[model samples]
Target: MTGVPLLDPEIPLPPDFPNRMLTHMFASPIETDIAPSGTLLGLLQRGRGDGWLHALAAPRPDAVAALNHCVLRDPRPDWQLEHRSLYYARLYRELDAPLDAIGEHLFDPVDALEECEQRTGLALSVLGHLVTAGRQDALALLRRYAVTGANWRWALDELAVREDDAGLRELGPAILARFPGTEAGERALIEAVRDSFEPRPWHLWAEDPARSGQRERLARALEIGDFDRWQRQLRPPTPQPGWSVRAVLDWAREGYEQTPRQWREAAAARCLGAVAGPGDREVLLRAAVEGPSPVVRAAALRHLAERGDPAVFELIQRAAEEPDEELAQAAVTAYARMNDDGALRQARGWLERTDELGRTAAVMLARRGSAPDAPGVLAALRRVVRTRGTDAKELRALVEGSARLAIGPAVPVLRHIYRQTISSQLRGHTARALAVTDPTFASGFAVECLWDCEEETREVAAHHAATADARVLDRLRSLAADPAEQEGVQTAVRGRLAPS
Candidate 1:
């Protein structure tokens, strides 16, 4: 006899497992017309608008299996960046799916190895939303998990947001017991009290006579936390108006010697700009080239560039050629800030070089380049993506630049990045770029984008997706009606559906 599969066969198992029974899931094929959800396994993987529609319409067991697989494994490329909890929770409520799979996943023996929030955050969050939807069973499960689960704090926070006062008060002893009775435990308890997101339970506990010792400890900790914040704000190396340009420079040098923070160095540069007289240009010039600290040199270069000093262009070029990476990046940033025609001329000249400076020049041109600069910007973007691939965070500026220049040729590259990149934010950027660059976007990618995990992507879809497809209109109407949908998205949907 064959051994039973751990999960239902129709559910798409995570790729980490090597079981012979495991079946890989792929996205449903997109066509000119909207297609019905066919295989439950594929519905679970694609997680598009069609996935939700299919999962809801499939057989009860198949739909439940698909829902459980998604909630337990979290199929999104980046959980921190993309949203799946609410999506899964809505499906769970629609199916009235049993919580056995979720319960087993949460309380599994393997939780010892995977005790962090990442493993169970999606399930807990879905349960949290279910509680908000007036599911009493979901609320009870959350309470049980909050008291006994490995990631209890997350559960407790969720309950704090949704559960009644009496419910939260009952959890005090269990949560407090996690801290030991010793002095170290008391300190830990104080920290927990100070850092709590929902302070109502702590406040109620602080007033209870039965827990006087814990209350006093928490009260003192809260006072100390406030005092610490005040002390931090009051103590500083603030700039004074009486300081001369040389004095401010010396102050910057001293601070750099002590702490060497980039923000502090930038503040020092602003101070120099405020105090410098006509006669101080020579000193500023010298500091840009020969300052002992790179921070000082960078600050001076930034100030000089912002002031549009004519000689600073040659100095910026020298700094870019310097072996120091930090200084070179600073020079590039300073050069980008220059609004003069010379900066544009110099950027065009640097565009041909295949160095870090060349990449920086390309980004600057993308941001500030005129309509005439589109071809050069597109060429630079192609080279950068070809060299670094779609995963490079550095390409974001160029991606926006392609949109700003409205480069039609860059549409294919943007679409490729949209499909290949794992970053939700990057995908959102790609969607906005496509909205402007590609004429077919309203009917093609925009339709699939309605099911995109990011709300911003959904907003883009609402604004641009063609409503000729039945699925598009249904999703748009649902979004418009849902109170949970973002106001911006709702507005877009309303505007799109409004009679012209």
Candidate 2:
């Protein structure tokens, strides 16, 4: 009834195990270390194929327990990125897993105050997948949580996608009650309406004849949301004072001091480009070499890089060797953005360096470099995936490079990455790549891709899944006519079915 019981009675808890991790846990991706890939927990957490194979071979209770532990604890440090819920949900169905642990975890008293997605996001997401898989209990729990759970917004999103109109209408009063007629409440309601992942429930509520009061409130919120968006668009960011090089430099220094994010430096660089003159070159160059602040130096580096300054490459190489990792990283990033002949040549040299500079160079070449660059891209892809796993930041570009260059050796690595990655975004991209490179795609992964949680994935499946199979036509037809389907997906679906 509390948190999920320790990996079934067949599996003993580790001696260091603390309380049900649902309570008294510190969740930070910075601290989340990768588990040993050979272990079932590691495999499941990483969304790897071996994890599923191991789970099936392990005692059913132990496998279910390990799974429940993962769902309740929320393994991924950045819960928002990399999607494991659908993957986990499929595992659950494969095992015909019980929902008692999931139910208990969602209802645990800790959920009342601890609504941060880090706490229960995985559980909620897994539940959504089960709901789509025709699990009534999962659907029921989502509805219940939507009213009382701290993370009601997420639950509402899950329900919006699959729940019936009658069921969704029942939630309007409970949800609306949380935001009263008070000014703060009104603002919150407006934002909620504006930000809901799916707008169907709001739209349905607004059209319901019986919920006149709810309809009016939703309408008012929508109108305010539209006005807010219009206002934001009207306010284009520009120099506070009429443009001057000194003023822009001063502005960058100030913005950097206030909140030194990389994006601010990039913004300042754009402003500097507009105001800088032939005479101002000395000052900009001086700032790039010996700036008072990192913001100024980074901005100057970006500006020089963008303008293709003859001396820019030297400046970049120098900064990259400097002690400040931040500036060094900035320089490398700036250099990576360049696509001209010199930059491409420089990238070839970087392929041999074993640092972040080298990593970004591989990504750069993967994205824009020619077919001859395939060997280098393939090598980087294998090395990064081996050392850092599929979730590495460079994974997408590496996969794309493989497909673009038609790197024959990359198919194995791509397939491994597709199997191991927790990111639906990454998986969808891999699917796109595989459609081009993998000979087995149409009859293999593409068939199941149609049932994937992400619509982009479904669209990919629609385009490439072997139409010789009977189910392919059925799925395509269903997608073509489904009002909830995305426009791009519908286009693919209709194209596949137009002849029939």
Candidate 3:
């Protein structure tokens, strides 16, 4: 199968088109120049609601072919990131698309059992939606897949949402047969029964006389799970008031020696904070500086920083400069949390250094610095981008700080990150920064953002995109009328359309 040529929006593919060609078509970017809503393929790529409208209006065979390609292949880079299944399902209901393509795709011999869920999850979700829309064919197809498919648990859960007891009862033996009669299989079945998203089908099967053994196992597992949760709550390893500060520190050190978990040390720090008396300040200060274990030392620093102890600032400075990466990071985190003016002053002094501690100081200033600190934040953002590029996750705080401080010089860099970053969430943060800093945002990127895959990005566009362009107004109107549009987005659209 070869890729489909870029065709006119109105043109339909031949009915005999190959399935692999559809995959190739989606693998490449859409070639259309207009808004994604203008073409069926482009709309699908963007996962826009307009795709549903466009697909419905396209030639029936062509639309069905395109929709099947998407459901079967799973085109999105991240399925969890985009909204496609519900949109595709709604179109299926409107078009009454046949189930043959779906069945063939589900039963394809090439894909292994491991790949089945990822490949068919969207299609299964679509079928689930269609069944809810009262499509008998959809329900029957779901039942067939649940019994025969490798991702049967997913299919079963879908059916559980809409299928009645009688419809569900007939499938118990087939579903149960997948689990062997061995101990391992029984354990797997217990886990499946315990973790099921929808319990209706399991509940129904558990009551049946033929499945009494499976029912007893499931009930036992559920009881143990509940009791375990209760036991954990009743005897949590919290700090007691009678323990002295040294004992609390030793208790923390004991956990660190056994498991070496960072969070355990942090929890212990909170315990030390509760138990430490005024007379124990000097002892804690000494531990923060020279404790035997780095975990104990870091925890002491964190506790002292929280207490607003004056002597701890120099200790933080020393720890921040330490060669040990974990201790340094913990020190920087503690320094960032401090509310003292001296911490801010120290942050300003350290902003010129080019090491990790320097970057940490810049981030601290970006987060807590006033408007006067915009230049330093902008400098840190550019330095990180120039050195590490936009893919750095560490740039998130600096990106947000650049926006919060409204640094005009940061707009170009922010725009660069927005354009080049693959992360939808990062792009969202960039959009928000642009909304505040870019004067022309309403007339520029805001228009394109209306078709963004992330709802929050769309919400930002809705609130800020200039209504001057015909495209923006049309999209706003479409979003306002679509019941499936997020409530935050619709609220923004209404605010824009509201009579002044």
Candidate 4:
């Protein structure tokens, strides 16, 4: 229920779409070795607001080289999710950087066979921004890539946003050629039309005045795409666990038979809320604690813990210490789902332990703990910064909790996270927290935050940065004027302005 459009996972999607196999290997998070922060490469890698500032001060050749390296290599911890492309594109514009390096990277035939959006998404995104900024070369390159590249859809989506209606109309035949007359081809075309990240091009082609044949075909695709989406909305596929406790237990057993550790118990547990009754409580309790089926036992434990069943509270505490790490994680997650006073008390009790459950407990308090819980939350924040540093995923929850409680004492740690974390999202969270906890933020990070890589961070800066600083005023006015800035950031900038 993320509100994101999804293809039916039960049906086979186009093999060309990103399919992440669990068996596939991955490098560690942010493990790509970055140079010193003082260097241009490192600054861009970190996506720092001041990256361009450093680039401007460096030699033009050095700056261009660093910028090219970053754009081509993709320095993000997770390229699929990060926001470095627009930032890099802006730098490219500022530097008037050449497109040769980017062009070469985009067309590298060596990596063409293994077509993942991860390969060219950042480059295409940067080129998209450049095209919007009036780089005709970028527009032309994207047009060509749409025909030849493995990641052509990304290029097409970019073109959809910035290309002229005439330019889009010309591509109708090429896009149509992607599907042949076969049944599978038609379905693929329908799926592509359905799963498109941007629909403007499709919508435009469906009604092109001069191209009656293209229009008819595209119109059919649009009609079918809309119908498929509507059908999915009207009746979601049936749940595998069905509508009763016994059915759920049987489903869990079936899942366990397929994969010992990859059982359907967690999903089965979710169904228990609708069907379990007084008659089923003992069965659930027995399955949770003593059942021969590991899957049933796990599901029952999750259901009970999620319901905050006091009968299973001790089981939660003990299971978190189980020899099976997956079971321990499942048990701890169930414990965190509890929203009762007893859960809060349990979280408070575990504040001293540094295990996963202990950390989850600390986060629980940080999120839902009261005024009296502020001290514990602050202590937890400090301890995590000391133990795991600012980039730790755990810090995101704790930083938000600190902000929620307005814990002034947590300012130092929040400031540290803002300064040290290489993650733009984490830095954004820290910026928000520091706005409340740090009085000096208006004159300090707030000024630099105006130039931050992430739009949301800049939005926060706009709301809080002091008007007295000359840099703040200039940056805010620029952001207000910049068409490339997000609507939210521009709105925030406008809110802080005097009426012209």
lDDT of predicted model 2: 0.77
Best by TM-score: 4
Better of 1 and 4 by lDDT: 4
Top lDDT hit: 4
What TM-score does model 1 achieve against the real structure? 0.74
Give candidate 4 regions above 4 Å deviation: 1-31, 36-38, 234-243, 259-262
- Comparing 3 with 4 on lDDT, the higher-scoring candidate is 4
Query: What local lDDT score does residue 148 receive in model 1, on the 0 to 100 scale?
Result: 77
Query: On residues 1-500, what C-alpha lDDT tens digit does candidate 4 reach at each position?
Result: 01111222322222322432222222322235555444567667778776766786789999999888777766777676678888888889988988998888788885477555776778899999999899998888899888778888999999998998999989988877878978999888889999999999998888889889888887898999999998989884445566789888888777777744456766788788778987888899888776666667778899988777888778877778878776677788788788888898989999888888889999999889989989988887877766665566778889999999999978767766665566888888899998988898887777777877888988999999888877778888988888899999998999999776
lDDT of each: 0.75, 0.77, 0.74, 0.79
Q: Tell me each candidate's TM-score.
A: 0.74, 0.75, 0.70, 0.88
* Pick by TM-score: 1 or 4, better one: 4
RMSD of each: 8.7, 7.8, 9.0, 9.1
Candidate 3 Cα lDDT to native: 0.74
Task: Estimate, for each residue in 1-500, the C-alpha lDDT of model 1 and write its tens digit.
Answer: 01111232322223422431233442311111111123454444435444666677689898898777667776555567777777777788788888888989888887766645777888899999989988888898898887778887788888988988777777777777888878898777767776677777777666666777767866776776667667778886676634686676666666667743433457777887888877989999999999877777888899898888889889998999999888888888888778787787788989887877788788878888989989989888778766666656557888899999999988777866665454567778888999999998888778877766568888999999888877888888888988767788899999998899
Q: Considering only N, C-alpha and C atoms within 3 Å, which residue pairs clash in candidate 2?
A: none
The 10 consecutive residues of candidate 4 with the worst lDDT sum are: 1-10
Q: For all candidates, what are the clash counts?
A: 0, 0, 0, 0
lDDT of 2 by residue, 1-500 (tens): 01111132322233333332233323342234444444566657656434665687899998998788778777664566655787688789889999999888888898776746677778888899898888898988998889888888889998998898998998888888889799999999999988788888888887778988888989998888878878988897754634887777778777767734434577787888788878888888999999988778888998888888878888988888889888898898899788788778878988977777889889989998998898899888877876676678898888888888888767767776665565657877898888899888887768767766566777888899898867678778866765545788899888888876
